[model samples]
Each structure stands twice: as structure tokens, then as C-alpha cells.
Target: MILWSARWKSRIGASTIRGMTESSTQKDYLFKTIGVIGVGLLGGSIAAAARQRNLVETILGAGRNPSRMRAAQQSGLLDRGTTNIAETAAQSDLVIVCTPVNHIVQFIQTVAKNSRAGTIITDVGSTKQQICEQLKGTLPAEVTFVASHPLAGSEKSGYEFSDQNLFQDRPCVITPDESVPAEAVSRVRQFWEALGMHVLQTTPVKHDLILAETSHLPHVVASALAATLATENFRYTSTGFRDTTRIAGGDPTLWIEILLSNRDAIVTSLEKYTQSLQQFKEAILNNDEKQLRQLLEDGKKKHDTLNSAP
Candidate 1:
């Protein structure tokens, strides 16, 4: 079982109480040391944000590349760096796996095997269902694994482009199943809150489905839009064109893993999107002004609502 400090109990009663206390408290270094596996953009940003906010006394980084690890250390993003996953997992109070989605389960298993009892583990994988399902009964009983996905990051990749404020005011979804301890859930939620994220709770399946439409679909659309524009057409492009295709610049390898991991949901979303496009095209071909106007108006209203939402 995980043990919480008296301060944690005194501060954590209701969600409202937790928020009030966290905002009022001077220091909230819940973890003594945090181990971040795969210290690239997402991982490096987490380390930088934690250090900037004084959320952890030490941030230990581990990656597959020794040179990248050394560079992360030299960049002031890590107190210590290594290529050994188990060693770092064993030493830290909390371990956050930031590796690619395909490798998340392997890292989680390694962490569980090496980490001490009561250590908390989490990941930043974009999709959750597969990881959560694979880890169902695999982790040590005493070790807590909370699946998390932060809705932040730009089209950019690598630690060089990472920002300490990357997660500030951004949404982070935590998908904890019934098997996870309540205390563990609370700790993970508080950890993300400390990093300046708006925490939301949902199930792994729901997270993947929702993100498939809202995130993955957009990336696909953006890439498709960019692909149609010839290099010679660059001079004709405007801000609207640039804005619509910005995410197309995201790392193709990373996106391929994400798309493949959530293939079912993404494909469903794509089918629906394709139907909508067909409807729009048909309206244009028929010169149905009313239908085109109504479609455009509906889109405008939905976009406006999203912009106005908190």
C-alpha cells in the first residue's frame, strides 16, 4: 500500500479542497525524486517544468541513447542521466515512461520489476487502451500504474524545442481503472496539477476514442491538406493555409505509431469525416447554395463554441 504524508491527507479531502490547498501551499514537492524514461521533448519538458516549479527535489532521466541523456543533463533538464532503465526506476519515488507508445508496456514492465514497493508509475503515451490493458495484471501489486496523456505539445520534436511551460494551462487526462488504488490516483492527479495542467478523468477506451476524433483526425486532415499543395504554390499561400497545415510538420514516425495504436477509432473517425466531405462536395457540385450555407454556418457555430469553451 502507498503511504501519504500527513500533509497530503490534511490537504486532500475533496477535489475542491485539494485545489484550494494546492494553490495556497508554498511548497508541494510530493515526490522526492522523479525518474523520466525517454528524455526527449515530452520527457524533457516534464523534467524542466518540475524543476522550474520545485515540484521534485531531483529529476532523473533515462533514455536509449547515452548522448541524448548527457545532452539532457547538460541542458539542466536532469540532475542525473543514464541509459539504464531499471536502475533509474529503482531509485526514484515515481517513474514516468515517455517512450513511444509501442515501447510503453515494455518500459512499464521493466519499471515494475525494478521499482520498490509503493512506487508510482505513469506514462505520457497518446493512446491508452492498449497500454492499460497490457499492464492490467503485470505490474507488482504494491506498485501503482496510472495511465496519463497530456493534451499538449506542438508539431515540433526533440528536447531542443521543449519548453518548461509546455503543459501550463493545458489539459491532461488520467485513465485509471478500478484496480488502481484511490491514493495512487490522487497522487497522479496532484502531480499533473503541480505541473500546471487542468486534470480530467476518464477511462482508457474513452480517452482513445475522443482523441481519435479531436486530435488524430486533425493531424490526418492537416497532412492531407499539406500534401495537395505543390511547392510552386508556396507564394499563393496565406496565414489560413499555414495554420491549417501546421501540424502536418509533426514527426511522421511518431504519428505513425500513434495512428497505428489507435487504428480502430481513427479509422471510424476518418470514415465519418469522409462522409461529411462527400456531402460538402455534392452540395457544391449541385450548386445548392442553401445547403452549402447551412453546412458552413453549422461549422462556424461549432468552432465558435469550442473557442468559447473553458
Candidate 2:
């Protein structure tokens, strides 16, 4: 979470004194204490990244899972891990909400009840528009809310599967509103960069639109394919089917929350996809060889374009 004050404009480039050492105070401006509200893959990875880079002096991990929190503490993923969410939120300068989308608002309300006035609040949710809207409706005027989406994750879950380098060279989207402090936004960007990510900026609306097509659609399609192919009588599938459906094996609990939370955007994307599929179906039914060839060519070109690096 990154919060900005009206006076931050003057403090943007100025150095701050921390512990008797002025030493290029730019690094200390962003965040010194980070609170991660989930100790699973996303939260553990964030804590690991902060530790690996010494990005944060302290990190507090919070989750309902006692065993997971203890594992995170023992594994050096967080300076402290606790089952109490309010306790973690109170101590953190910046709190990263990494819980399921369904739990986001509840967590925010809990944090508001316990956290100090100036603590920043941000999230790593795939959908931003809804989250941002919820924040505007619920959060206090002092607590700044920045919606972010990290475009990196493995199919694996849990603290044991977390890797320090999970964010390396990956895209992290930071969506800040006009009300958000410029300094706060910059600090959030800086923090992500420190974690070895390529940061990009966008509005919550724009982020939702773009991700609905490129990211959400893929997951929906992959899941649909996986569901369609599974039958009691069916047997003996090859590598192509296995590879294509691999992401469908993602945590159903997580995906259910995601799909439901971002229903509007996903619905719009699915409608467009249905139209495209209808075209392909019609071409196949009519035995339109040229149309089929052109579609394949277009698909190949699109895949190539996506595969090109930044």
C-alpha cells in the first residue's frame, strides 16, 4: 500500500534521514516495513523477494493458516508471521493485500479498524477496476489505495512452492488514481523495481480491459478446454492436450473467486470470443479451405507477436 499526502510534492526528491545516515535517502522513501496478508505463494514470494534484496527492514506475514505462517517464519520469508491480521496491519508502513479477491474487502475493513492513519494499502489482484471502486467506497481519506497486478505466477501454490526470483523480469502493473499521491505512486513503482520487476503504469479501467482480453480470457479458455475434454470414456491423451490444459489445473478455489469477481469483464471478453469461434465454426462447416488457411495464418502471426519480448 502506498499513500500520498498533499505535501509529498515537496518531499518527492528530498532525502530523508534514517538512523543517523543520510546516504542517498531515496531508497528509504518508498517503504521500510511491508506487511503481507497472505503467506501462501504470492505472499511468501513477496517476502522472499524483499529479503533477498533487503528491500524492507521488516516484513510481517498474516494468514489464518497457522502451519503455513510458522513455515514462512522458519523459512526466512518474513521477519514475523502471525494469525492476527490486525496486528500485522498495525505495524506495517505499507500493507500488501494478497488474499483471495473474495476476502479483499473484508480484509480492508479489518485493516481500517486497526491500522494507523498513514499506512498505505495496495493489492496484487488480477482485476483492478472493481477493487479500486471498492476502495473508493470503503477506505478512509488518509489511507491511499493503489491497485496492482503482478503478471507472474506459477501453477504451484503454498509457501513451499514460492521462489525469490518469481518476479524477476516480470511485468507489474501499478494503477493509481488522480487522488493518489504522485510520490506514493513513484515509491510503489520503485519498490516493485527493487524486487526485480519491470513496472508499468495504467488506470484501473485500462488495466481491467487489457487483462480481460490477454490474461483472463486465456485462463477461461484453458479451463473450458480442460473441462470439455474430460469424460469417463475418454482415455490416452497426448502432450499437446496436456500442455494446453496444464493451467486448467490451477487452484479451483482461487480461480472461482477470480472469475466471479471479474465477471463483467470476463463476460464481455467471452462474448467476443464466442463470435470469433462462430466464424471458425462456420468456415469449418462450409469447408472454406482459404478461410481456414487465413485463420491459421492469423493465429500464427498473433502468437508470434505475443511471444516477442519487451
Candidate 3:
């Protein structure tokens, strides 16, 4: 509610994230033309990665801003750039919707309308339930969908901050219901794997719940922690504080949609986190050395796992 972090601005998907990881191999062109909608960090990085690995024949970018699209095209990240959503969809064999959670369902519908038969469409959205459920039975019979979320991003936005290696060694989740074809799912998987991602598969419901804790909940906690300081205390902050609150710098507009779409799961995560926090507080308040040490040890043990995470 408090729009405090946009000033410092500059982030998703992590989840029981079980998946198969294949090593980077000889890059073969995966698709004829790949269309990317909303060429922000993830989208731009996808475009960049495809180009760097020569994964596609052509990369087309779409956005509301014509100038920005044109700039991305000029940078060679996109072979074509336009404000025309239908054109991008029609020309693409694979369409990657990189828009925010709220816009994805509607926007992909527009894309599906204009796409040719057998066009494979995927997304890098934060939440999967709303999008996957809403589009479940709705996409044109000719178009195929495999909802996905790549668990890597920066607190930065835009094409300039995007790196071709952004998806490298990171988990890229794919959520496909039973109706989607195995061939279609493989097509989406091949695309991400070519970009150096370790592919993960899960139900949309599971993806939503898992990411709410690993991704959405952290953003919420980061924002809450960042908002505690007064402007006068800004100069007193240091690297540790900035690192802890780095995600708080993400675009609020994008995150609000994520928070709302995954409301129930995020609330559950918040409840769990708060319960843990209360224990820490009680331990400190009572100056209970044994309890404090145990709590700290538990947190350390859990956090250390991140060091070995793939």
C-alpha cells in the first residue's frame, strides 16, 4: 500500500522444485520465429539468450511503447519490434508472454487469436494458477500453451539490464495440464534448456504454492523490512541492509499483481514466517541463551541449503 520502494528501484519463480537438468549442448535452432511480449528483464534476456545461443531464426518483440520496441530491435536483441500484438503472434512459431501476472491471460488470448495452428506459447509469469486455470480450456484449438516461470531475475528492469546468461543454471518451471500435448511441452522445454536453464515440471497449483514461499513471500518481507527506515536514517544503511532489501527495489506495480493473484498462498507463508519471527522475539526478550542459540542454529542450517541449491 505504501509505494515506498520505487525510488530505490531497480526481480521470480522458485519452488520442491524437482526437475531434470541437462548440460549445455550444441545449440541447434529450436524454432523458426520466436515472439516475446513485454521485453523487460526476463523477456529481453530470453531474446538475448536465444540470439547468443542461436536458438531461433528470428526474434520479434512486442510492447505498448513503440519507441522502446524499436530500441530493442536496433540493439539486435529483436529482429523485429512492433506495438502490434497480433502481428507478433501471427509471425511467431513460439510466443513467450513476459508480461505481469494480471495481463498474461488476456494478452495471451490476443496472441492465440492471431497465431497459426500448432503455435507454442509459454509465459514467464510469477503466479501460475490464475493464468493456467483461466486459459485452461480457452485457447484456440490451433494454439498450444505450456505455462512457465524461470526462477532467475534481477531487481532491475528493461533490456539494458538483461544478460544472455540470466537463465543459465537456474530453474525454469513448466506447468502443463493433462490436455496439453507431450510434444508441445517438450518444445517449450527445449527452448529453455537451450538457454541453459534446468527445466522443472509441476502442476500450476503446486507451482503457485511453492513460489509464494520462495519468491513472493521474500518480496513481501523485503518490502516490509525496507519500509521501516526513516529518510534521515538512509545514510546510516550499509551493504548488508541493502542486500537484505534488494528485492524491495522491484517494480511495485508488477509485484502487487503477483501478491494478489497468489493471495492465499502468500498469506499462508506470511503466517508461517511471522510465527517463526515471534519465537525469535520471545527468545530475545527473555534473554534465553539456549533458545536464542537454538533458533539461530536452525535458521543457519536452513539457510545453508541455499548455498548448495542448483
Candidate 4:
């Protein structure tokens, strides 16, 4: 088992580690204080999960809305809530920027400015290439920024809908460039692992491309499908329709930002998706039962492979 060195032990503090005996099954309390910026669904869920798992001693929340933050604090989603991002960053061992994709880089810049040396910073933004590029050379050498996207959450929003198990058994992709310190990457990986996430490492560019196909494209398709349904069709909706369009009900503002941030990759995925749709239309137009069956079988096999994969 890996042990904390004297330097880390000193940094972690004796009080925080008090009564924490080293054991194989012991959960790692990786952060003494965790600062979560934007205490909305994803941010609130992270704070709640960390508290439930005892992964952090304290969770400081920073957001634009005071009333929302106050409600979150009262609901036990945060230990304290503030509008000052820098102040929260200053006190936190790790700062997680959970704001919208557009605001994440600015939040990280604020955090980097106020945070001391050796602080590890990360973001939960859906797109990474832009964020990683914007953050490059903006932070002090002593600070580390690791971009992460947790493949979790639901169509639900707000702190009220947040759950402690939001990220349980979920895949979290960590995008760490060569500029990031090796130790910082390990710490962030362990932190996510403590939250019960299966940490996957990849480059920021690759992550953006993959998420465009897997996440952004799906949301776009769902929204389009839902939009195509007439208002009168709601009464005739079945489980299949509702299931396919569930994500269409997500916050439009958030999805707009995500799509725009990764527009290039999303557009590429959309082109491919449209091509497939065109092929399907052609098969139907020609009354080609064999081609249609083959297409359906191929899709089913691909989905089955995904479902059966570890």
C-alpha cells in the first residue's frame, strides 16, 4: 500500500488525520478542505458525495446566487457558501470548478491567483480542450490544473435533486497534459477513486472528441427528437418515446454552452450521424428489407457489445 510521505503528512495536518489508522480498506481522506464552485446539480452532488463518504473534512461552496447557496448550505450540501471564489480557493487543499463550461476557465484563473503553492485544481466541465488550452500558462508553477469530466448525473437540476451517489460506479475522465505534475495527476486520480468513480485518463483533445460522439451528440439527437414531437403527441407518448427524450428536458442554457464550447467536434459527429440517418432513409425508400435488417443488427450488436463490456 502506498503511504503518505512526511511532506504530505505535514501538509495534511495531524488534526485532519487524527484517529485515522492506516488500513487496507480505509477510505482515503485526500483533501482537508474541498472548494466547490457553482453549487448546482453537479457541484452540489460532488459536495454531498464527498461528505457522505467522509472524503473531505470540509466543503466550501462558491456560486453566483446567494439564496441558492444558502439553500444548499441548509440542505447539507455545503459546509459554508460564499460568493468569493478566491477566498474559498485559498482555504481549500483542492478546488473543483463546477461552473458552466464558459465560466470554468475564469473560475480556475481566480482560484489560481488566490491559492497557495501545491494546491491542486480541477474542473467538472463537459468539454476539456478549450478549458485546458485557456488554462495553459495561466497558473503558477506551484499550482496544478487537471481537467476532468464525470460521466454521471441526470436530466435533473438544482441542489434539491443532487444525490450522494450521483457519481457512484461512474466513469470519470481525467485529462492531464504533460505540463501537469505526475504527483498532481495521481492525487486527482485517487481523489476521484475515493468518490467511487472509475478514473480514466486521456488527453484533452481526445476526451472532447469522444464526448462529442458519446454525450453531446446524444443530447442533440434527443432534443431534436423531442422537438419533432407535436404538443398533441404528448398524450400518445409511450415509455420508448419518454426514455429516448428524457435528456431533452435538461437545462437548455447549460447544453447550449456545452455544444458551443465543443462545436467543431459536435459538428463532425452530427455530420456522421446525419449520414447514417440518410442511409436508413434510403433503405426505407428502396424497400430493402435485407439492408434494413443488416443495419438494425449492426446497431444492436454494437449496443450489446457496449452493455457487456466491463
Candidate 5:
């Protein structure tokens, strides 16, 4: 939701570079206040990390339930709490929409309407293309939207399970379109990096496709695997069975939004996966030991490469 300025092109070349390589410890107190729209795992953890790193003067929590906001404020996770989106955005220098993908667009529209000039807007949404598309030009000239997805979270949800260290050593992707100012993108990247994340940037389309393969597909597979098992077999399950399907335990409501949002990309990944499964099925039925061994080895090598990465 950014209106482009001619001057930002002068420094556009440096935006991605600074995002990837900047090591400035001078990032303290970059914002006077940051408002987190949801008080769930990612949102609460962001509040915790910003506090621990001394990155802001104040932290605010905005959500639906008044009782939860009171609890978060009482727990010291937020300096203030409010159910009013405008009230939070009006006071925040930076507003992060941490709601699920389905609600992010509407929340952002509210934020853009109420945010003061020069306020920076961002999100922890896992999917970005739709958000970017829906809110493309709907902003005040000074309010900026830099879509971000922190590639960090747990099957578990809620504030109590949120750890400040959750983003440590994790990857965060910021998707800023051509109309966004380079300076805005750099600021959002700095926000994530200050929290111990490795930052990257790309088109929202590419981000969705990549995450479809690495994250969404896996969750679907895990849930499907878990569903295939019988209730009577639960007592006989071992670590391998449990480990393979642990992501199935994630809240079904949240996962539903994620799955449908990126269903196109996820379907592509699933087609490739089903082909692999078919190959394995044929190999097993034909008793082709060599073919089965080669498929297993191929999977192992790919996994080994991932584990070997620094």
C-alpha cells in the first residue's frame, strides 16, 4: 500500500544488498512504538524479541478479545493493549499485522486508514501474493506496506508458548513490490535482522511458490499421514510415527487459511509428490530392489545436503 517516489530509485540498487549484509548494531530504538495486531505465537514473540533487544520505546498489542489483551499487558508483553485497530495504528510508528492470512488484508486496510504519515506497515503472513495484490495502491502516500513472512513458528500456537528466541537462526522473507520505496524495504529488513533472523527478499509470487514446497506441502502431507492411521493403532505408535505427523497437530483453522491461500502453488508441489509416490509404488509392486534403493538414496542425499548447510 505504498505510493512510489521518484527519489527512491536513486538508492534502489542498495536496498537488497543492505537487507542481506548489514551488520549494524546501531539498530536500537529504530521505532518509538510498534503495534502487533495479533497476540499469538509469532506476534507475542515479536513483542518479546523487540523488548529483549531494546529495539523500541514501547510495544502495543491489538486483538479481538479484551481479556487476552489485559493478560498480555499484565504479563509485560505489551506496554498497552487495545481492541481498536485505529487506536493501535494511530500510536505506532510501525504496525505489524500478525493475524492469519485471511484477516490480514482487512486489518491492513484499517491500519492504512488510521496510521499517521511516515508509519511503516508490515506483516508476518505466510502468504503474500494475495495481500500484495489486494492492497496494491490503497494507502496514504507516506504509509508503506512491506510484506514479510518469518519462516519461523511452531505447530503450537498462543502467547504462552511464544519464545523470544523463536526467530533466532531462522529465515525471514520480505516481499516489496516495485512501487515500494527502497528505504522502506531496508527498514523492514533491519527490523527482522535485529531479532536474530537471516533476511532475504523476493517477489511475492516466488515466496509463495517456495514456501508451498518447503512448508505448506509438508504440513498437508503430515496431516494426511496422521489421518491414515486408525485410532486403535494410536497406542502402538512409536517416535517415527509421531515425528512424521507432529505438524498435523497444528490448529486446523489456521492451516485451512494457509492451504487455500496458496492452493495453486501447493497443487503444483503435490503433483510432483504424487508422481514420486507412484514411482515408489511401482517399484515396490514390481519388487525392483535396485529402483527402490535408488529412490531412497536420492531422498537421503537431498536431506543430507539440507542438514549439512551452515
Candidate 6:
């Protein structure tokens, strides 16, 4: 399935024939060129990390925005950049779809036709179930498709904000269905680890449910809290209020897509959140000092535990 191969070697050094053969086979049969389908913060960071560590022989970026693609190329994040997804997929040994959640299925479909046989495909989406479902039917059987989500990001977007070390020691969750080859899954894990990330494996459904509470709920609550405070007492706000709501200022379009794509899990999370809020409200209304104090103390303890956690 591969077109060519390259063995890792220094100009002045030589390798055993067996070592060279294995390296060449790994480059050709395992991985070589890595394609990133959205060179914004997450994609750019991945590309930069791969290049920094020589994880792949080449990194190519593709996106609708030519300007961002050019920026990624000029910033040393990618070896090449283009607006054509097919070209990127066709040329890459590994393809990481890093576009917004809403665009992921469409992008995969767009590039699927041109993806080479045995090309390893992956994604960096917040939710994984819908993405896995779409890829299950549309992606070619020859292409090894695996879903992954790296648990690292900033409340920022755009290529300019990308950091090469964004995934360093971060938890990168991989969701592979039964149809995925064991070797392919291992290769995907090895690739993420090569980028200095710790790999965690989970089912797509589990990932969606856990993240709905641990990730999406926090973003929604932060935005809601900021909106309520700004409406009622913006004039009295200070650094503490600003810091707490900082993530609320994240890209609205991106968040909306993520929320809508994973609506079922998010709705479940919201129901639990609303029940907790109602309990607090009832405590205040009944003038139950003990209940109110317990609620506040519990919240403080939980926050402290999270802050102190590894």
C-alpha cells in the first residue's frame, strides 16, 4: 500500500542491514507522512509535536482557509499545506482529522475516496460516537479508522495560538470499535505516545458520557455563570470573576457544534446539574443554614480535591 520507504540514519553512521530493513519497512508499512486536516490550535499543535520529535517523515496540513494553511506552513508546523483534503489524504501514511465536530464526517467523506489503502485514519473530536458511526459506513475498509481525543487545549483558537508542547504528557483517549485491527490500534497508540502523550483507551459511548460531564458541562456552566453575573453585577466584578469565566470566552461556533453533536450526553449532564442547582436553591429558600453550609463546604472540598489531584 505504501509508495516508498526510508530508514532513519545519520549521514556519518551506518545501521545493520536487518535494522535498516526493519526501519524502512516501518516507515513504509507502519507510518511516514502524517496529514492533519485542520491546522488550527489542535491540529497545528499535533503537527508541530510530530515534527519536533520526528515521529513522521513529513506532516501535511489541509483546511478550507488558505490563509490559515499558509500560516501553518510558514510557522514550521507542517511540511506542506493545502485546501484540498483529498490531496492530503492521498499522500499521507497517517491522517488526523482535526476539524470541528460538525465538519468531521463531511471532511472524512470528502477525503475517503482518495485515501491510500492501509492509511491509518484518526480524529481529535470532543465526542466520538457520531464520528465513529459515520466513519463505520463511509470510510473504506482498507483505511484503518480510529477515533481519539487528546485531553489538552487552551481557551484559544487559530494557528497563531498553537503550542508544540500542548500534548506533552496529556491524556489522549483512543476509541476503537471491534472492526479496527489490533495492529492498527496499537500503531495509533504508538503514534500518540511518540508525540509525548499518554494514551487512554475507551469505548466511544463511554468517552461521550464522561466528557459530557467532565468537559462540556464545565464550559456550559462557565458561560452561563458569566452571562448571569454580567447581566446582574458586571460593575462589581473583579479578577476572580474574570478568571473563573475565562473559558466562557472560547470560540462560540466551535462550542455550539460540539454541544449539538453530543446533545444526548450533554442533556443527561444538564439534568444532573439542574438537580444539584435546585437543591441549592431549595436550601436558600427554606433558610436551612445547615444544608446551605454543607453544600458550600462540599463544593469547596470538591474544588480543592480537583486542584490538588494529579
Model 2 worst lDDT run, 10 consecutive residues: 1-10
Q: Assess the local accuracy of residue 122 in candidate 3 as a C-alpha lDDT between 0 and 100.
A: 92
Instruction: Please estimate how well model 1 matches the true structure, expressed as its whole-model Cα lDDT.
Output: 0.87
lDDT of 1 by residue, 114-162 (tens): 9999999999999999999998888778789999999988888887666
Off by over 4 Å in 5: 1-28
Instruction: Judge candidate 2 against the unseen true structure and give its global Cα lDDT, from 0 to 1.
Output: 0.79
Kindly give the stretch of ten consecutive residues in candidate 3 with the minimal lDDT sum.
Answer: 7-16
Each candidate's number of clashing pairs is 0, 3, 0, 0, 0, 0
Error of 2 at 152 (Å): 1.6
Local lDDT at 103 for model 6: 88
Q: Write the per-residue lDDT of candidate 2 for residues 1-310, one digit (tens) a residue.
A: 0121222222222212333465544455467788998777888788777766657667799999887687666555666788999899899888988898778867877876678888888788888877777767677776777777888787888876667799999999999888889877877888889888999999888888888888888898988998887586357787888888778878889888888777788899999999889889989999999998888898889889878956
- What is the lDDT, from 0 to 100, of the residue 117 in candidate 1? 92
CA-lDDT, candidates in order: 0.87, 0.79, 0.86, 0.86, 0.87, 0.82
Q: Give the clashing pairs for model 6.
A: none
Model 3 misplacement above 4 A: 1-28
Q: Model 2 compared with the native: what TM-score?
A: 0.86
Q: Residues 277-303, candidate 4, lDDT per residue (tens digit)?
A: 998999999999999998899899999
Q: Per-residue lDDT of 1-310 in model 5, one digit per residue for the tens? A: 0211222222233333544664633444678789999989999899888876767767899999999888777667777867988999999999999998899999999999999999999999889899899888777787999999999999888876667799998999999989889998998999999999999999999999999999999999999999999999899999999999989999899999999999999999999999999999999999999999999999999999999988
Those runs of model 4 whose alpha carbons end farther than 4 Å from true positions after fitting are: 1-28
- Model 1 lowest lDDT segment of ten: 1-10
